[model samples]
Target: MSVIDDAIVWLNDPLNWTNPDGIISRTGEHLWISAAAVALGCAVAWPLGVWMGHVGRGGAAVVTVTNLSRAVPTVALLTIFPLTAIGFGPKAIILALSLFAIPPLLANAYLGVREVDPEVRDAGRGMGLSAWQLLRKVELPLAVPYLANGFRIAAVQVVATATLAAFVNGGGLGMIISRGFGLGLASGGGQVLAGGMLVALLCLTIEGVLALIEKALLPKSLRRVKHRPPASVADALPAGS
Candidate 1:
């Protein structure tokens, strides 16, 4: 049979999914590791990015971080962690993936806050809104879409990359591919193909779900509406007259 045909057969086999080391179990591991990593990345990136963008500084810092993240291959980190205090296992994978997740999150958050209409900021300031009040009431609401998009990008990247956990005995879907390779090409090609297909499918599923959520929360009309400061601010404003 062709590799595709063999992969279909393997995927359909109830036994492959029911065993101790099965698709379901591996997928669970993949999601857990990916979630932990993405959460860690968000925790570190969001506040720093938002602050930098809020104050109109740190553009160079964001670029440097983006470049550094892109320059360092995740797989290299996975291998190197084993030699450090981190040693092996899921923690190492999570740390590496967190680094991988940072650049997009940081870039999007900074850009989002910066993209807020300057007119809106002026309107708020004219009303005597404090910096904290402006950020809380005006900038953050407008930037929600960008923040959501960043999360989607980071999450998708994490889910796809989590497959590498197999390399560190982290027990993710990548283990299936590695095991297949261990069996040699002629014997294991189907398994390798099947594992790859599963990872692709999982990534697509996550992306679609997050996109739908972002759209629902920040619908088109709502996204376009500008934030208006309190009546006190508006009343105090000098008329065009």
Candidate 2:
């Protein structure tokens, strides 16, 4: 049988879906670790990005740090963490994944606040709004879409990358793939294919859910409306006074 056919058979088997090492349990483990890493990345990067953008300071620093993070390979981090105090455990995996998630979160957050219209800031100040009030009310509202996009991107990336957890025996969907490979391809090819498909499906699901959330969080005016035919020129004109 073909790999796809075998994968289907493997997936349909009740035994594969039960037990402590089942797909369901592994999926939950995958989500938990991904969530922890993304949350940690947010907690570390978001506020700093917002503050730096608001104050218009450290633009260079933000760029440098973001670039540095992006330049480092996540696999390299995974390999290096075992020698550190973090040890070869879930903490090491989570920390490595969180580091991988930080770049987009930081860059988008900075750009979001920085890109807020200057006129809006001036208008707020003219109304006796303090700097904090202006940022809270004016900048953050305008920046919501950017923030949401960053979060969505980070989340999808983390979900996909969390498969690396199995490399350290951290237990996630990756473990399924690794276990399959351990058993040799001739007998385990079906398991490998099934695990890959599951991870891809999970990533797509995360992206779709987060995209909907991002759309919902947008202002009503900013929400995408269906395209319509142009109105006739007469209809475009105001009624006779």
In angstroms, the error of model 2 at 78 is: 1.6
TM-score of each: 0.89, 0.88
How does candidate 1 score on lDDT? 0.84
TM-score of 1: 0.89
Q: Per-residue CA lDDT of candidate 2, range 68-144, in tens?
A: 77678777888788779988777888999998788777776787788788998899999999999998999887877
Worst 10 residues of 2 by lDDT: 225-234
Predicted candidate 1 versus true structure: per-residue lDDT over 1-241, tens digit per residue: 9999889999999989978899998888899999999999999989988998999998777767776777787888988887789877778889889988888888778878998999999999999999999999999888887777778889999998888877767788899999999999798999999999998899999999987887788878545423321111123335651
Q: Which stretches of candidate 2 lie over 4 Å from their true place?
A: 222-241
Report lDDT per candidate: 0.84, 0.82
Model 1 alpha-carbon drift over 4 Å, by segment: 222-241
